[model samples]
Target chain A: MVLSQKLHEAFKGTVERITSHRTVSAFKEKGVLSVTEFIIAGDNLVSKCPTWSWESGEPSKRKPYLPAEKQFLITRNVPCLRRAASVEEEYEAAGGEVLLDNEDNDGWLATHGKPRETKEDEEDNLPSMDSLEIGKKNSIQSIPSYFGGEEDEDIPDMAEYEEPDNLIETDPATLQSTYLVAHEPDDDNILRTRTYDVSITYDKYYQTPRVWLTGYDESRMLLRPELVLEDVSQDHARKTVTIEDHPHLPGKHASVHPCRHGAVMKKIIDVLMSRGVEPEVDKYLFLFLKFVASVIPTIEYDYTMDFDLGSSSR
Target chain B: MADASEKKPILQFAPFQSVVDEGFWHRLSSLKLNKLGIDDSPVPISGFYAPCSHAQVSNHLTLLSESLPTEASEQAACTSSVSLGNRNKCSVPGTIYNTNTLEGYHALDKQSLLKAEAKKIWDDIHSGKALEDSAALSRFLIISFADLKKWNFYYWFAFPALVLEPAATLVGIKPASQWLSPEEAEYLSAACREWRNSNLTADVPFFLVSIASDSSATIRHLKDWEACKGNGHKLLFGFYDPCHLPHNPGWPLRNYLTLIFIKWNIRRIHFLCYRENRGFADMGLSLVGEALISVPEVWKDLNSVPNAVGWEYNMGKKGSKCVNLAKAMDPTKLAIAAA
Candidate 1:
């Protein structure tokens, strides 16, 4: 049978095993409900497997591969709050006054000693028909009528309503013109967090998918040639990688020299094809993850697990 | 000088010019005390005023320092300036000072004169003529700004160098420019589009829009966004602000969002704000569920939103206290019901 046919068969069987009711039930029993949980759990399982081992670096060493740093993990995209001040701090800075002491004062009774005029009496005292017509024609003419009319004796001096200059004393600091600085010390460590754009392109010369890394520094600035030296392993940097100006990216990026990736990929493809798997460009990432699981068990490369299974309509 | 060849380039400092009133300085000093409760002595009256200047000279200085080698290669580099191509042509000056005119000595607009002097200092530093003058120049700039009541600008310029001094010593170079270059922006936009297209399904037709400094690019993206409206596909606006200067992203992002929200009447938007070239450093994913007439104090956190499953696993241990868009938009939730 053809290699494709064999790979198709193998892929079908694997998919079946992954989605089986028994496997699902077992996973649930083990308290693993999500794909991420399953993958993480699988990492532990794969690590203990006798067939799996770290293949890179020195063969004489027992565990040559460096342990994964927490910082290197590309888990989630968190919001950069590098310079964001807390809302409370901002409010306080904006001169917001919080009333701590609130004592209800009913001073209206003392201010007006006599009982107020009844609504009925006030209505009766309102301007009559002749005066009302004149008031409508010229609104300004009615102002004097109220000032010197029957209610004139009740009207208090205008000085009583005048607002004091210092009614609510404002701090001089609040009035000061404050200017913003160009940059702040990225105290949140947001600037130091590194992220890389990894691309695998076919190198026709070697007939393999060569990995290229465009590293971004904490500030999201492209890593200069010197900065790229920091992220890569010394051996890889010296022998297998070349730092050059990126054809597309303006800045210099580090590209790993063609290694065993093509041979490994071809071998995996052959194995899958022998099990009846068809050639699929889309399945490359999935296949890569499965193949590398044996060597790099702890690598979190599966993004499909991030999908919401319940919302499969998407 | 004992040896003319070994003589140092004469460094000149701008004369002191106090523009603002002494009373204003006193008020500013007192205001600082009132705000921070740290009583500060009033700034001396005899300091020079430094205006907010452009970064062109610094950028050129950085380029020159990077390209040219000092010591034995200085003569060779100067000769090769002619062959270094058209890029270097504009930078090469006939003379450091215009000897024909009294432009340097008699210029009355102190700000412009000081800016020219600063540029000359940077040029000298890049040329290896004034190697040890950086500390003195920095001090001069700081004192000048402090006296001028422009401590904000002083802190912005001086703080980074102070904090990164140790690292800079090890690296033997100043910190690289923080902002994304135009080329990097283009590459990033293409990369994001490719990623979105590859991952997109019929049910989840994710759209990636790249925003840059150009207004036309933004408008073009908006047009594309409008076309996707009511198509059942979710709109994911990828905002890339090329402004790498400090305190820039907030205002620029706010302005861009304001323009788009008002023009399109977009009730809700899912945005990823990022810097270019930095694959994902300082990148944030947020959802603004309301018609943002003005920029909000805090954008809705991505992890808190429903169907935003990819990022939940990586939530900080303290757990994000950001305003949850999913909860905020739900009508059933009385706490965030629309007013």
Candidate 2:
């Protein structure tokens, strides 16, 4: 496709290429366009125009002509260093013309292909990379996911998880003082507090919670279904168990809550959400949206995350 | 958001019916179980067994022993139980995998062995190997002794399948709730089709081929089904009416499911109502179609039963009664009713 001068000027100074691959050049004029190499420093980094191409190869079948306009170097936004660079690049590349990682501001829609909204306006639009795309060399992955929004929400309906009352070492005074203690464990707090040492935040779509459930969610890479709170519903007695279909689940059928899965999910969501450990599980949770006949479609997914709540691996 | 109310779940604590171990156990006691087409003796046949061949039968048991798993081998070795006069030779080891009977049946090698046994069995009528001891029994035994042996074997397997997984086990309640197996379903379907075309009912009266214990409950349930014999062939795995209980444990859930199903599925149905009120209450159960409230005496008689009709309210179960099946269905399905 031929790029008009106006388009060229638009990308002139911003585009940067770290590795010289002629194939990745933003503009292809008989496939020989220049590739640019760029590595930006911090959060203040913005997309500038692609002005030059970095050269580094013997052009052949094994080695290709370097594209000057395509090379762009950026920094890591995750917990570690060099890995964050790769994640940010992947997020940007994955978003491409139609940003899958786009944040909601008037529910940002891509017109024709390119992003309609500016990246600056959408604060929740953090370039988050998924777990599968994590390159072997880039192990320093980002823990911060969209679920735990970088910006605060309007009226956070998100339930703030508190350690269950039983897990906490409250003096008798506290117990006597409040009748409405949320989590009162049945057994001693010792083992009660010693959970599986992991937390997970799942978007509405990623539910069947393959962890500790009858089946697996094939779409996700997180195969070992976690016995996190969401897969189980907490009862008034502070005991959390796998909630089953009302007609079948034998003992106590939770079917009365037709949205029992969602409701139970909400309780687990309340916990990891309080802390900002939201992992990006948007793809899994989003599919379930159609089944939720009633929830308004306008509610933009909280960029916070789809499923990110990971924990200190024991 | 339009309203905060949309978030709450519409249904709460859906009505659930639980069959405690005691309830199912006591109820299943009266069921012949064989009525479900389950085999009593699940024999693992292998060798030259005729429908009446003693040598082949003995070889089969020897194989049954030889293939037993280590644990089971020791158990069988200790008891050393014997049958078909080969008791001493029945000490062959066995494994869990030894029971695959299909290979032996299909093997060309065994067909000759079976034909030989069949030939010898056709020659002798009083050899004592003939099961059921009848002249025509050869026809029954000849068709597929292997299948009969296997079915009988499974029928016998039910003894353990019934006991080892006693109704007390959480899974056993399934047999109580759903006594019909896929096999039984096939039998009923075939039987119905066959009867639809023939005059089998007139040749033999539609009296139940059902068997029950001499236990009081079994006798009472058998009598209830017999009274309902009416003018057609109806088979029922009989259990006493709940009212027959000494303490009258309200209405029995199993019989309630059973009686209602029979009325709805089988033609020419007429079941004697034990407790008019309880029966009416059962009619309220959706699994069972509506009871003929058309009979005013049935309703009037129900007046005598305690906690009968309106009893579902005390127990948190939905009125899935045949009369209320509509209420039991999704509103969407109700909108488009079928013919």
> Considering every candidate listed, which one attains the maximal DockQ?
1
Residue-level lDDT of model 1, residues B7-72, one tens digit each, is 322211111111111122223333343442332322211111111111110011111111222224
Worst 10 residues of 2 chain B by lDDT: B155-164
Q: What is the alpha-carbon RMSD of candidate 2 to the true structure? A: 32.5
How well does each candidate superpose onto the true structure, as a TM-score?
Answer: 0.26, 0.17
What TM-score does chain A of each model score against the native chain A?
0.30, 0.15
Report lDDT (CA) for all predictions. 0.27, 0.21
TM-score of 2: 0.17
How many clashing residue pairs appear in each of the predictions shown?
17, 90
The Cα RMSD across the true interface for model 1 is 28.8
Q: Specify the CAPRI tier of model 1.
A: incorrect
Give me the candidate number with maximum lDDT: 1
After TM-score superposition, the amount by which residue B3's alpha carbon in candidate 1 deviates from its true location, in angstroms, is 77
